[model samples]
Target: MVDSIRQYLSWYGFLFSLGLALVWVLMRIAAIARADVSRYFVDRLMLWISIGVVFGGRLGYVVLYEPEEFLAHPVRILSLDAGGMSFHGGLIGASLAVFLLGRASGYSLWALADIASSSAPIGLLCGRIGNFMNGEMYGPPTTLPWGVVFPSPGPERRHPTQLYEMLTEGVLLLVLLYPLNFSSWSRRHLGSLFGLFLIFYALVRIAIEPLRADNWNYQLAGVAVTAGQIYSLPMIAVGLVILGRSLSAARLRDRV
Candidate 1:
């Protein structure tokens, strides 16, 4: 019993799931509490968007990475109970929800995106912690002292890459988004925050793919990649285009 308990602790069990649930609840609470005046805060919108993200993310995982198995059992694709969701798909789904909501409510798409971006890190940080608990995306062989001996089927010590991502894409992004609200940067160019968030996230995710444990993407021209990186490239490109347009608009506004 003691050994089982110790293994559970080291493996990161229910504690991780609890952390995600806690953050999600807190975000809902925050939306409810701030709904009085903040255009960005809406309980229904948040709930719907969350649903879209989870559903889309799961579908994307099967469609992009494991289509063969899913093809064999089409019904299993919808069974998220087994656990598989792609971050890129979730982003796309959430963005679609936001777009629809924004158009209906007369809110700017990027402005809504900015509001969502601020809250993104919370989910990301929690999700990575959950990943650490699951021991699914462990890193390649490493001689570093901090290397983890995962109770996973492998005997090799690997880098805690998930934690690394949590720090950069989650914690650091949150810090960056805070001061951005007070700055005039976005005011001059609406969507600057959103664009930057997407671009930065894509760059960071792509940079970390090399350290990933598995090469889950198709190889193109002798370059091995992962599904995560492939999905991220479009985000970076779109962000760059948005950034350029924002700058041009700002310049035109100044001229006018």
Candidate 2:
């Protein structure tokens, strides 16, 4: 059944879904930002973010995961058709784009970040589903009833880590952020939402790293650690800093 579904699933449909996800999230972010800035501000920001996601995701994959291979073949950097992307890299790229837009437009960087972070999960959800359809990013062999036998990794049944990501990072994050996005407290304390997003996503990524068969493993302070966990550690720290500042600013406002 799984093989049949994978075979019949349209690649075009997957691409379309990704495109659709981008459009939907961009529109939603733009709508939220419209109240604060000009109608075109969000549009321009989204364009930069799109560029960032492509370049940053690609470059990140090269720098972080496959530096040796990409270094050997510099020409392959442009070959995005080969399929390699890193979400951490994409986040960094998007954050840089947001910072650039903020500087150019004289807008609040934190506000823009909150808007982008709120809608990011939709794109993630679609991307994970695409991973599943391609039978990539599956976990180690499993005996569970729901274990999937992917085509590329032989006949052994494996955990559907892609679906797990979809549920946690995509759906769960969306649900958590949706209410916060609309809350008055979040509006007053800009950056809190974005901070929470970073924290939550980093934690989830770390939690699931052990399940991913392809993750690079290492020893950190005698603890078994994956590359994903190492990359995510900084996000937690940054999130805490941002969240602390937001709350501190809010408290100061109350005293005034």
Candidate 3:
């Protein structure tokens, strides 16, 4: 059973399926929650989101992680089997997709964002596991009892950063989303869940970057920091702005 499962879900195939599955789940949840929303509109939005994530992730990976290789062979960017994707890039793409779709469909932008954010942790959780299974993105050596010795990084025990991401970015993310998911007030208060997800996920990514030895590093103002952490800082600031505005608006609505 295990061998059969492994054979079917190779890296390229897994990523393709993951994006589609998450979109399906997100649209289904939204449909169930607001039965009045047109299912056909949801389907159109899903197509955009899926395309955004795939292309965005791929291009971002090329630009951020492998600019030289991409420049040398520009056509290589289309090679999905080579395996490179960026989470931040995909987020950017997906957000843009939603914004455009919302504008066309006459749906609330933040409301769509909130619905997607509430459920995206499931994809993050699964993605981290995919990383672990592929024996990629392991962390530096650690003496902790729970450290794993992945086949790629030699026999030394290392922090399983993938699992850490799964725990912090995935399970804990779901926990934070739980209240927003069930509360009627939260649903009506557009952007609350959307901002919360960005803030929480950004914080988790920044915290975890330090533990990841394989992360891309660059020097900034005589200080060395991982690229992941650098990218997350902007997300944190943006999230704070969105969250503050959303809260203020909700308060104003309540008063009225």
- TM-score of every candidate relative to the true structure: 0.83, 0.89, 0.88
RMSD of 2: 4.3
TM-score of candidate 1 on Cα atoms, chains taken together: 0.83
Off by over 4 Å in 3: 1-12, 34-36, 80-83
Tens-digit per-residue lDDT, 1-256, candidate 2 = 3444444346524753585467456546545644654546777878888888867877888898889887898876666544468888988898899899888888788878887887788788888887788787899999999999999899999999999999999899888885675567777898888999999999999999899998889999999999889999999999999999999999999999
Residue 138, candidate 1: alpha-carbon lDDT: 77
Higher-scoring candidate on TM-score, 2 or 3: 2
Give me the candidate number with maximum TM-score.
2
Candidate 3 per-residue C-alpha lDDT over 167-194 given as tens digits, one digit per residue, 9 for 90 to 100: 9988899778844655676655778888
Q: What is the lDDT of residue 210 in candidate 3?
A: 82
The Cα error of candidate 3 at residue 62, in Å, is 1.2
Local distance difference test, per candidate? 0.72, 0.81, 0.79
- Among all windows of ten consecutive residues in candidate 3, which has the lowest summed lDDT? 1-10
- What is the number of backbone collisions in each predicted candidate, taken in the order shown? 0, 0, 0
* Best model number under lDDT: 2
lDDT of 1 by residue, 142-254 (tens): 98999997877478789999899899888888777635655567556777777888998999999997787855767867988887888899998998998788889999999
Off by over 4 Å in 2: 1-30, 81-83
Kindly report which residue stretches of model 1 are placed more than 4 angstroms away from their true locations once superposed.
Answer: 1-41, 78-83
- Residue 130 of candidate 3: its Cα lDDT? 78
